[model samples]
Target: MSTSRLFSVLDKALPDEKIIQDFSDRIWNDKELNGTYVELNNEWKFIPDNAPLDIVTKALFKEYFEIPFGTYKVMVAIGGNYKSGTWIFDSKILFCNALS
Candidate 1:
């Protein structure tokens, strides 16, 4: 396996935590999280905004937006997707929030 593959492996196996998750789904043994980003129905249009809010809710929303101040991302990885203890997305870009 390549380095990227190894990282992917561990990310799925040992995703320490998943925060601020509202909507989520799993497909064919794949675990997914959603509703963290405020955006349209499309995978795109997820813009970032750091503003003032209550301490708690804003912190919760921050989990989804981990990149720059104003951008969009999808598939903010938390963990899960291993095959028999083989971790995937372990060290590559599991925490990467896609830009849109």
Candidate 2:
């Protein structure tokens, strides 16, 4: 997807709730990460791996945000469609505070 469109979808998915917006902006502006959304089973899933958006977001949260290392699944709706993924975050408190 185009960079503008990606940020738009990310904003819709994650919203502009303080740190969440910071995190989303980081992902959108990071030069090293060339991530994209892919359609799977009629849903768009962002999987964390060595490549793509999921891994990039995971790494950013871990290193930049200093979130603990673990896995967490988060889902958000964009334009009546759902986007879900597994994110790496060890602390439930941190997750709740950061994303809630």
Lowest summed lDDT window (length 10), candidate 2: 52-61
Judged by whole-model lDDT over C-alpha atoms, candidate 2 comes out at 0.37
TM-score for candidate 2: 0.21
lDDT tens digits, residue span 34-88, model 2? 5434455697654222222221131112245646542232332222222344643
- lDDT (Cα atoms) of all candidates against the true structure: 0.31, 0.37
TM-score between candidate 1 and the true structure? 0.18
* Candidate 1: tens digits of C-alpha lDDT, residues 36-81: 3443455543222221111111111234646554332244433322
TM-score for each candidate, following the candidate numbering = 0.18, 0.21
Give the lDDT of residue 12 in candidate 1.
Answer: 64
lDDT of 1: 0.31
Best by TM-score: 2
Ten contiguous residues minimizing lDDT sum, candidate 1: 51-60
lDDT score for residue 75 of model 2: 32
